[model samples]
Target: MLANPALQAFSMFLVGTALTLGDVHSHVWARACWCLTDVLFLMAFVQWLRWPGSYGRKLESIWYLRWGGRVSLRKAAEIVYSEARAQESVWAHAAERMSLDKSPDGILCYIAEVIKQDTTIYGKRPPSTHVEKLDPLQLKYGTVTNGAREVRMRDNAKTVFTDLQVDAKELRRALHEVRESLRTTMPI
Candidate 1:
């Protein structure tokens, strides 16, 4: 029960609801127990929701640093990958606790797939040495070409050209692909 928060919550909720709805209403002790159980279930649910073994937070942090000019895409990717690899055990434990259908190793392989996809996206930046240098003024204030916004050059002279809008459907498709791959790879 300690290992399975959802099950603990569900069992508590079931017993609490039964006590509240059934003939146990006349007993004050039963009502108090029910309230306690319900509160425990809520706490367990919140704890489960706040589980820190999430890749999304890591990705968001990388994106934030990149957008804020604190790190380049390549550097962000390296950090993200290193963090993901370091947290593999946490992720595996999370998978074991959260899922009964898929094995922990299967969840790890899913994480690997996401890491590969993200690496491809963030690793495609042009090498710093190959970046074409612009005028100092142009470097200070990047120009927009064909409506695409160009980000300022880093100290290493690498610039990022962004379209300012990402397709929501494409992002959803990538996430769905990761989930679908996990489902498909799991044993029946």
Candidate 2:
């Protein structure tokens, strides 16, 4: 029901040509062009009905690029995923997940995976982070040492705080700090 003006005009031209030629004498080419135009108009209307306005517009733009041979299927898929990830709903879900107590470890693991993938893809590391420098200490020991800690501690028993309670608030704060640091220093 939605009509693109140019398509409508072309369809009208085809119809007029057929009418002038008479129904019985109409050329097959005129009938074919009209039918094709009608089908295209219907398809466009159906697509407009199917998607929300903004999404439909974005899809239409991408569709043009795809059929125009300006982008490959793989690149189109990557563009779609990037656009989807930037959506507010997606970001909200990510924020909620990252705010959880277990998320910091998962996030760090994901970052490590991304680093690995980037290295494999580009044959080099993507960028540097504080985690890169502290990773060895964190892996060898359970924690990283601030220089102040060495001055206050005499023994391994004194260095480790077994009684420390990490509540959800503290975990969330720690995750935020880590996220901020990574955002500042890394492309992630």
Candidate 3:
């Protein structure tokens, strides 16, 4: 599209003429519509050129981060494990020994597993842990959706921290283990 100088000049001329004439009720409306149609068509074409499942995969990663931020690594893991246990998955066995207030690391480990499984199937980065460094995925997806209230993780720190067992050492180790395991097990 950018390589077509005549098309670019024509679009610019149409736009400038339309603006100077300010004739919304005249042929300018048709020009405007055509311009919009062209832009949309180009955008659709570009979107179609993208890899299959990439958009949905990106959306899932983003949702995971936003939701993950609402809870600590510990609590997020527990929520995942709790859901898994309720479904009676074998992964739930990992969480059987720990109480909600006692196993932040276990939760982190479980969260890692949950994310690994997801990314394996979906083909995008997974939810990150508290100890994990921020990735391009997080940076891309962490922005608040339009008109949506921004959730501040720090403002909810008390609840998040409380939900977590808050053992720094254990949480650290859990994060490291999960990161390592995911690196090895997650499909590219």
Best by TM-score: 1
Q: Which ten residues in a row have the lowest lDDT in candidate 2?
A: 116-125
Measured by TM-score, how close is model 2 to the native structure? 0.23
lDDT of 1 by residue, 1-188 (tens): 46565566566667667776786746675666667677777776676455344668655643654454333332332333334334443333443455433643334333333333332222112434333323434433442222122333354665664322222333334333433342322466
Clashing pairs in 1: none
Give the Å error, residue 69, model 1: 31
Q: Summarize candidate 2's per-residue lDDT along 13-67 as a digit string, tens digits.
A: 6675766577656567666766666776676676555543467566764464434
Which of the two, 2 or 3, has more lDDT?
Answer: 3
Worst 10 residues of 1 by lDDT: 116-125
Ordered list by TM-score, greatest first:
1, 2, 3
Q: Rank by lDDT, highest first.
A: 1, 3, 2
> What TM-score against the true fold does each predicted structure earn?
0.29, 0.23, 0.23
Residue runs of model 3 more than 4 Å from their true location after superposition: 1-69, 94-104, 116-133, 136-188
Compose the digit string of candidate 3's lDDT tens values, residues 1-188.
67544465566656757665785667766676567656756765665444234566545433544443333433435434443543444445544444242344534453543443323111112232343333334323332211111211223322111122223333334334443342222366
* Candidate 3: pairs in clash: none
